[model samples]
Target: MISLQSGELFDTTIKDLLIPADKVAHVQLGNNLEHALLVLTKTGYTAVPVLDPHFTLHGLISSTHILDSILGLERIEFERLETMKVEEVMNTNIPRLNLNDQVMTGLNLVIDHPFVCVENDEAVFEGIFTRRAVLKQLDRRIKNK
Candidate 1:
């Protein structure tokens, strides 16, 4: 599995992970979960960032949410659930990670929370790091060492 020294891997912002700077999918505050699904489908991503009315970081709409909504486990309004905004269902209590955080620190956070939102001090959505990413990065480091 991937692993990293507590403070190794990242010497700068989480922006480094955005390295090749891929086009990350995002949903506006007024946008609904349906939009999130469209973005995920187009990008083939598991999650997308959620922005508030003023474009501030709100939370994230993940595939899990979609699955839950589909399974009828989520409190979606059935017929008009897709029309509901992300704030109505996205996990707003999510923990966020900073750019300067250590790889191990980030890993630990993900260990506790399957998905961690990587962001800046102002809470701008930078990226979403999953437990798999941490493990992959750690494995790369171990092989190199």
Candidate 2:
């Protein structure tokens, strides 16, 4: 539960909510998943975006995906695994929130999507939102008491 003073709750814009570019953690598509795992573990991030050689957004991968591969119940082949590119893994039908969108709209998408890629209609990767970020914002509001 949250409570705030009248002026305390600033209508948070996406620009205000977005994890700034400097704060975003992302990986290149060519990078090995092993290295990606290392980064994820170090940063405590569940997933990260994969970018192309030209820095174009490709897709996202998560720790769960890696764990599924390692569990081997599916018995994936190395060649087939190699073909399992981030573009193939990431949710292409990404739900995004525009910079002008209301904070609650973004919060609704976050309920289902672990992270939503912030972008224009062209789907450029601007930044991402994690549960941590949202909670952090909420914590700020509570502390404003």
Maximum-lDDT candidate? 1
Model 2 TM-score relative to the real fold? 0.69
Q: Estimate the lDDT of model 2.
A: 0.65
- Relative to the true structure, candidate 1 reaches a TM of 0.68
Error of 2 at 74 (Å): 9.3
Candidate 1: residue pairs that collide:
2-138, 2-139, 3-138, 3-139, 14-99
Cα misplacement distance, residue 47 of candidate 1 (Å) = 2.9
lDDT of 2 by residue, 37-111 (tens): 667898998887776655456667787766565555566444444444454455445576666666677778888
- lDDT for 40 in candidate 2 is 82
Residue 66 local lDDT, model 2 = 61
Among residues 3 or more apart in sequence or in different chains, the pairs in candidate 2 whose N, CA or C atoms overlap within 3 Å are: none
Clashing pairs counted in every model: 5, 0
Error of 1 at 86 (Å): 1.7
Given candidate 2, what's the lDDT at residue 65?
68
lDDT of each: 0.66, 0.65
